[model samples]
Target: MNPLLKKLQELTTKLDSTSETLDSFRVFHGRGKIYPGLEFVTLDYYHPVLLLTLFNQPPEHWLNENLPLLQENISQKIQTIVVQHRYAPGDPSEIVYGELPEQVFAKRGALSFHLNLAKQQNIGFFLDIEPARKWLEQQAANRRILNLFAYTCSFSVVAIAAGAEKVVNVDMSSAALNQGRANHLLNGLDKNKSQYLAENILKSWGRIKKAGPYDLVILDPPSFQKGSFDSVKDYTKLVRRLPELMPSGGLVLSCLNNPDLDDQFLLDIFNSACPQATFLFRLPAHPDFPDAESNRQLKMLVFELATG
Candidate 1:
């Protein structure tokens, strides 16, 4: 048996047991674990498809030969297989096996969101942010939300599902925001209660602030977007303005995905910029995507502004 196959099976057993309720999740994240530069996940599990993403380097020729063995050995009944290369510039994801669907929906709790698995860099919804979604649902009741870099508005769906009064989703991509609007419609959430702003967040603070005095502010941004955001340098700028957007005693769900920066990077920024805002806790990444180093995992810090 191939060593990778054996490890995959073992990991699948552990992940599948607890993930029966979930329709989309990371089956493996092997950045510095089971395999270097490889990630394997099952998306739209209800539709039943597998996605294999390669990072750090291009895939070896052996992958074409070995993927079949992998598909045969896996426990789930995967109808489609897609492969994406993270570092390859402008390279489109390929459907390695079976047919690619026009649309795929994945369930989390009672809500379902569309997943874009073809012709894009991202599959639309991020599986690793499941913990934050769960947390938001628990605390979202009757609160106003501002979701920054709101890719496809997955968080908005969670907020709406959890009875949020209103949500504003801001992203630079009009296409993404349109998809977000569709997601809200798909879940039958009131479209009037949500606003989709398609503008550069940093430049549109004047516009964003108008919708604010928000009860819960959620920030989840890309690690690096050329000419847009550089986490180490630009993240602090967003942190400095937190006080202006959120009201006293409001909650802030801040997320950072840059592996190079540790949790303290965010903690220190929050502590310094908004001294009154207290760090509540770190949201845990799903167990299925464990990292050998906790700092490298997706970091979500819940902070509450001080009440006067």
Candidate 2:
């Protein structure tokens, strides 16, 4: 029922030169997602980022409709879609993110959601790692939780609801935090348990530290952010400082979202950057997911201070 997805189906069916399994894919600026037929997998590692289309057996004509949208432009190199969903007998897997699937994909225990369905962008809830939120909820009681770049505050709200003494959600947009606060209310959380500020994380870490040695720290930063961050240069600065915010043996959930950056990259960054900490473990996904790696969008590191 999504117009963009419907359009994607139309374009792929009409591709001039089609392949069974497309390895090198690209996303030219367009109104929709693009991909090959359902019989194979399609992706562009260099383009925008990591657009994917993998599926079982889907309708060729239906998938073809969306191919036009994936055509590459020599100028802007970006992946058109992040990943595609295939289901329903007439379903298509060799698809992209243009139109989100109709499925509601529930958030697992101790979790809330903030996602945009049917778009070739990030999912609202990042449903891949619900276990991390559950862990936060289990540990939040009587402690302060600092959530940085707290997009929807799903982490903050769950922390507060789980009995965190207080929570401070920091980001660059108060409006976004406002939605986060609303999520707190949605879960019947106490407003007094949480606080929010909109500020650049890099520019404001000292002030954040002044806020104190929080019980828990969560950092799932974007790979490349135009407005507030540069992943390659800024990530270490941010990653290194996280330990200072936690008390001895406190918890730190450090994450990286750029699929281009592998899980090993995160492990190395945290090990070197936060020397005072010992690795806990990576979080797991909910039962609904068939592909576990998708949740690897960000590699999460759990650590407790060595000094503590």
Candidate 3:
């Protein structure tokens, strides 16, 4: 047996052991957990598919050659396997095994999202933030939500399902927002109660503020989207303006995905910008994406405004 194949077999056995605990839809994070050189993800286990993302270097011939063997070892039937090279931005995924689907439907808890396996670069949802979605559902009753950088509006759908009064989803990409609309309909939620805006977030404060003061404000942004945001600088800018949009006693869910910046980085910004706001708690990362180092993990912190 090949060395890489042997390692893959061991990982598959581990995944099977915890299949029930993972809720059918789970992520097997391999970036820093199993394989240091690449980031391997099983996007969905119930209707199986694999995503092999190369973060460190160019693709190796051996990994490609042995993918079928890896596929065969798994207990469940895998629909397809997609490979993404993070180092090469414009490059398309190399389909190493089976046929690629135009779209794959994945369910997380009660909500479901549509993923474009072959066309879109991203599968369209962040699996690591599953805990936060579950948490937000608990907090959604009778609250108006402002979701900034609302890619695919996963948070919006979860909130609406939990009885949110209204939600305004703002993002630069109209295409992504359209998918968000589809996600809402997929879950049998009313699209009329939600507003979708395709505008630049920083410059569109005039438009975004009109819909506020919101009860729940969610900020989940990309770490570095070249021209739009540089998390290190702009995240603080967004935090500084929070008081203007949120009402007294309102809640803010701030998400930071930059591996370089730790949880304290966002805490410092929140404390300095809104001293009256209380740091509630940090959302725990998904068990599937466990890490030895704390900073490398995804950070999600909830803060509440001072009512008095």
Candidate 4:
């Protein structure tokens, strides 16, 4: 068997032996650059559906040869196989095998999140951030949280489910916030306990501050969002404001996913911007998504404010 099929078979075999409810996870992380000749491909298993995403065009015979073998090997466990072409205009997903369920969700432990499998670049949930969510599950109880760049509010959902006092979710997309609201409801949590702001986070600090003084702040911004946020130039601005948002002993879960930027990029920003804060630890990257250079992967660092 080829490397791709061998990897899929190994993953599926392991998953099939697990409990009834399978946790959504990355099946193959070719984008991590750990695998030769497949750096542009990624496969994600969102329960019944397996999504194969291609960042660049593959060899002409690649799909034709592999698709049939994939179906033959894992069709029993994975009902639908969807292929997404990211290089094409308006990244589209098409079903290569089986049928799609009317509603699709990515399940993580006791949590469930709506997935936009039909369209959209990101299918509502990020599997790689499970460690951060798991961390929030343990630390969020009785504390108020401010989630910036809160796409679909996955962090908010986990926080609320873990009995957080309150959570305010801020994002530029109202549509995503709407889905976030739905996610809260989907988890059977009280949606009213959280606030959703569909506005530019940088421009709406006053409104965001109105909901604080938060006990825990989550900074999970996009690497680059045209006209809104550019990590290189804008991260310092956000880091500088951390001191004003929370009191001493307050916790901050700051995340950066820019491959070009290392952990020091954030450490220096915090040192120069919010000198009162002290570094704690960096969250480890998900094992499945292995990068040759550790610094190129997602950086989730925790910090504590030393003074009010």
Candidate 5:
């Protein structure tokens, strides 16, 4: 057996039917660089579908040789196998084996997020942020949350499901916000408890502020979004404004996925941009996604503003 197939087979044995039914998670994290020669690939088990993503072109015979063996050896519960080529011109996804359901969702506990498997990039939800979602599940009750760069609003869904008083989701994509609304409805969360704003957060502070004095602020912006956001240049601007949007004692869940920027990048921004806010703790990354360099993985840090 190929090393990748052997590793995947070992992982499959660890996931019982009960756990697979309850959550979507990373099956293999090659980008973490723990596994040799597989750094350009990552695989996710989205319940019934297995999505294999290639960040760079693999050897010509690699997939042809390994995919059939993988399909035969992986879990029986995985009915569909899809391959996404990030290095390709369109970053397309091909259904290599079986068929995708008309409606695909990534299930996490009691929450379900709508996924677009055919999309060029990002199939709606992020699996690596499960720890932060679990944290929100514990702390979200009765709190007003402001989710910036909310993407499909997975955080909002988790927060609302966990009994948050209210959640305002802000993103530049109207299409993403629409899916976010659908996610809330899918989870049977009350629409009245949530607000969706399809606007650039930097230019719409007044609208965002109008929705708050938020009790919790979630900052999980993309590393780079072409003309819109460049984390290195724009994160400080967002952090500096948090003090005005949140009240004393409010909490901030600031996250960065860029490997190039370490935890100190956020610590420095919060320390300098919002001096009143004290660094709390960093949330641990999900165990499945382990990086050789700890700092290169996703960073989820919590901060609390001091009482006036």
Candidate 6:
């Protein structure tokens, strides 16, 4: 047998059904892999890709083994691995397993992700926004929050944890919104305090504006979306318009995932568009992420904006 197949054959077997989302799958504690109660299983739809997860070990070799491949191909860096539970059999689903790009090797606890079983990409949470997550956790308590482009609602999870009185998550994808809903449930957030909205941001701003005058708003749009935006020329316009939705002391958590644009572009946009909203700080990027000099193609920026 080949090395890969040989590795799989070595795994010990365990079986159980997933009550939360999936029906069932057999679990394997591969000899060389990590965890006891932890398991590796695949979903029916995406079994083509292996879902090496832990009900019980942290993510290991999968990411560490693959980093060289990712880094060699792109200097922009892979800060986290977004591992989603693949629904199909025999596929490459381990690539993006977390919101962050690095293969984190914590000696304790099983690995987990915010990405839902249904989303195509492995990214459950936006890993690049790790620090921003902590930032939100710190700032959002007791505030009225809105999350735009709220994929899987990782930001909402943090905001709710931070004690936000109410959080409205807006997204275009029903699947994505559903995942965010799941997250709110996962974190045991109060049902009455959180709300989910499925809408197009550019067109739904009227509704958003009414719901807002928010104390905290998160804007982490996809780099380029098909129906709603072309992040290149139109992103600044969106940034410019957000001040209308914010209260004087409200904070906007603005993020740009497009690496092609430089940080200076974001600085310029903030300078010109929301001049009244003080630029509190740019949250620190993750450590595992490659240095900016190594990357020439990415422009991921997370900023703290407060309406002064």
Which candidate tops lDDT?
4
lDDT of each: 0.79, 0.60, 0.77, 0.90, 0.89, 0.56
Clashes of each: 0, 27, 0, 0, 0, 36
In the range 1-308, model 6's lDDT, one tens digit per residue, is 32332333322111122223221122222322233222342111112223444322336675466434433432122233334434345322454533432222211012223433323444355444667777787888789988888877777777777788888888888888887777667656788887888898888878888776677777788888786887777777778876677655577777777656666777788788877666666666544233424233334344455644
- Give candidate 2 misplaced runs (Cα > 4 Å): 1-60, 63-123, 247-249, 285-287, 290-297
* Candidate 2: tens digits of C-alpha lDDT, residues 45-70: 32123344444444566556545444
Off by over 4 Å in 3: 1-27, 33-46
lDDT string, candidate 1, 132-155, tens digits:
998999999999999999989999
Give the higher-TM-score candidate: 2 or 3: 3
Model 5 spans with C-alpha error above 4 angstroms? 1-3, 11-22
Q: Looking at model 4, report the run of 10 residues with the lowest lDDT sum.
A: 240-249
TM-score of 4: 0.97
Q: Report per-prediction Cα RMSD to one decimal.
A: 3.1, 12.4, 3.2, 1.2, 1.6, 11.9
| lDDT for model 4 | 0.90
Model 2 Cα shift for residue 102 (angstroms): 16
TM-score of each: 0.89, 0.62, 0.87, 0.97, 0.96, 0.62
lDDT, candidate 4, 10-64, per-residue tens: 8678767886867888888898888899998998888899999999998899999
**In angstroms, how far off is 114's CA in candidate 5?**
0.7
Top candidate, metric TM-score: 4
What lDDT score is found at residue 245 in candidate 3?
86
Which sections of candidate 4 miss by over 4 Å? none
* Candidate 2 overall lDDT versus native: 0.60
At residue 292, give the lDDT of candidate 5. 92
